[model samples]
Target: MAGLAVPTWDPQTALLIGAILFEAIVLYVGYGGLERLVGPRLMELLVGGDSGVGQ
Candidate 1:
């Protein structure tokens, strides 16, 4: 494992990691919005009741 160690803080690695983080955040927000929009119906269908969330 020690032999596999690589340099850190290089620009390309930073950019790649940053892009992945940004994409993750975007997906999270997008899915959250979609859930907010239709989650109640889906939950009702699956759980057979209101999701226990106060409307």
Candidate 2:
């Protein structure tokens, strides 16, 4: 009778997971920057004048 086989590490799966993690980090930073750059302008346009919340 054969014993249970152990699972081997998969390089392709590891690389795929690494790439997904990298993309998520990049997207998080990129969106944060975009929000900082455009959030105030968007609020001004939607609210019509200075909200004065930041100041």
Candidate 3:
């Protein structure tokens, strides 16, 4: 197969990959929490309190 060969596990590569994964998870949780905290207020300001606009 012409596919690239996988490299053997190394401490540096493990740390780097772990850091990236940790950052992604942190970002996801942080943004989700912020959205939960402020999303309703933002929607209210943008669309007003009726919430059921179409119905």
Candidate 4:
């Protein structure tokens, strides 16, 4: 039977995980900013006029 073992610290794995987290955060913020920047224009084009909401 195998005994429970303590987790090992792997620098390469840690770096990989950190990079993925960083990329996720950047993508999230970048997409949100893009949406805020272009959402109104996109809606106007699709709706053919002002959305007419939030009056």
lDDT of 1 by residue, 1-55 (tens): 6878876698999999999999999999999999998988788788776568535
Task: Give the per-residue Cα lDDT of candidate 4 at 21.
Answer: 100
**Where is model 3 more than 4 Å wrong at Cα?**
1-7, 52-55
Runs in model 2 deviating more than 4 A are 1-7
lDDT of 4: 0.85
lDDT of 3 by residue, 1-55 (tens): 7668886899999999999999999999999999988988888789987986334
Ranking by TM-score: 4, 2, 3, 1
- TM-score, per-candidate, Cα-based: 0.64, 0.77, 0.75, 0.79
lDDT of each: 0.86, 0.88, 0.88, 0.85
Pairs that clash in candidate 3: none
Please give the RMSD of candidate 1 to the true structure: 4.3
Q: Cα deviation of 46 in candidate 1 (Å)?
A: 2.5
- lDDT by residue (5-48, candidate 4, tens digit) is 88897999999999999999999999999998898777777886
Question: Which regions of candidate 1 are displaced past 4 Å?
Answer: 1-8, 49-55
In angstroms, give how far residue 30 of model 3 lies from its true place.
0.4
> How far is 10's C-alpha from truth in model 4 (Å)?
1.0
Where model 4 places Cα greater than 4 Å from the true spot, the runs are 1-5, 53-55
Summarize candidate 2's per-residue lDDT along 7-46 as a digit string, tens digits: 7879999999999999999999999999999998888788
Worst window of 10 by summed lDDT in candidate 3: 46-55
